[model samples]
Target chain A: NAGVTQTPKFRILKIGQSMTLQCTQDMNHNYMYWYRQDPGMGLKLIYYSVGAGITDKGEVPNGYNVSRSTTEDFPLRLELAAPSQTSVYFCASSYGVGGKAFFGQGTRLTVV
Target chain B: AQTVTQSQPEMSVQEAETVTLSCTYDTSESDYYLFWYKQPPSRQMILVIRQEAYKQQNATENRFSVNFQKAAKSFSLKISDSQLGDAAMYFCAPAFFNAGGTSYGKLTFGQGTILTVHP
Candidate 1:
């Protein structure tokens, strides 16, 4: 169904390097979210977008940024990667408030 | 601010038996939603069940069910007839609506409980 697609399923970034994580959903959902999962830990919110042109920071948005220029695409940007940033990134989307969220397979990132 | 807590970090159950994962949350809002998400080794986060605070009846999906205690602020997931496929990490997540009800997707997740089914 191509519910939520995240590119670069696995990535290795050198310290201080920058990269963008791409996420797209074909469900035409209004709410999109970015989250990171550390090893043996729960998911933490990174960034979220309510709609096109509307974005907000989540619990752990320090080293990340996101933009939602279109309804289907929400990309997270890392300006200067650090070893702590190494984790699995997930993208999710929902129809609206009180709706079920569908998550992507996730992007496993490692910083050296 | 709202918080969710899953006390059991790891649990094991024999196949064909049942297991219950505990979760507790603290929230002042009267209206909210609770969800149980299962993340298998495949790393796919799947929604197991959901419960609304306003609803008095518990929510059930096939072999998965939830015991939602609004007053106590507890939401737990019970897996009946545990199978090897049921082994996974279960996360208890709660979503609260802002005053305007504009945020339908913001979620606070508990640490999660790892379920192991012994065949």
Candidate 2:
């Protein structure tokens, strides 16, 4: 089974451009999250959703947005991308908050 | 707010040898969870092991084991018989409750410790 899937394994965007990082999970989990990892750094939370239609901002939510329309999908949107937004983005899902999370392979985004 | 710390930015170990990565955290919550996730060159975050604050017994998975010191709020990972595949960036994460009753499931991650296995 495909535990977690992230589309566009790699992408490049010019400054002020916008794009969406798609993430879907087959585990039927209730919790989903978006995180970005800079080189040699740990993952930083960008957004999270406890369940469908319930989303919240995270530590690094300045240039990102997220929506959870269904239990299977949680997509992250990067608007007006900046150089600081260039990093590897990851999507994760968990049965619930504080539960073990299954992470996606990651999408490497570069903003020029 | 909770914070996780990994003081070691990099660590090296001879193949077949054992290495320990240290982690410390700060949190007021009495019940929570700690985890070690490994991100290899593939850039996939994989769960190495996990420990629940309320559980006295440490968690172990295959060649990986954790030393959980609740009082000190420290969680260290020990890898036995280190293999080339074990070389990766290790992150210590602590999960805690937010102001809202809903669980954050959000993780406070450390700066990350890079493990290098030398043959």
Best-performing candidate as measured by TM-score: 1
Model 2, runs deviating above 4 Å: B98-103
Q: What DockQ values do the models have?
A: 0.74, 0.80
**Per-residue lDDT tens digits of candidate 2, residues A1-112?**
9999999899999999999999999999998999999988999999988899999988889988888889999999889999999899999988865689899999999999
TM-score of chain A of each: 0.98, 0.97
i-RMS for every candidate (Å) is 1.2, 1.0
- Candidates in order have lDDT scores of 0.91, 0.90
Residue B76 in candidate 1, Cα distance off native in Å: 0.6
Candidate 2 backbone collisions, by pair = none
Chain B TM (all candidates): 0.94, 0.93
Q: What's the residue-level lDDT of B40 in candidate 2?
A: 88
Clashes of each: 1, 0
Query: RMSDs, each prediction?
Result: 1.0, 1.4
Query: What range of 10 consecutive residues in model 2 chain A has the weakest lDDT sum?
Result: A92-101
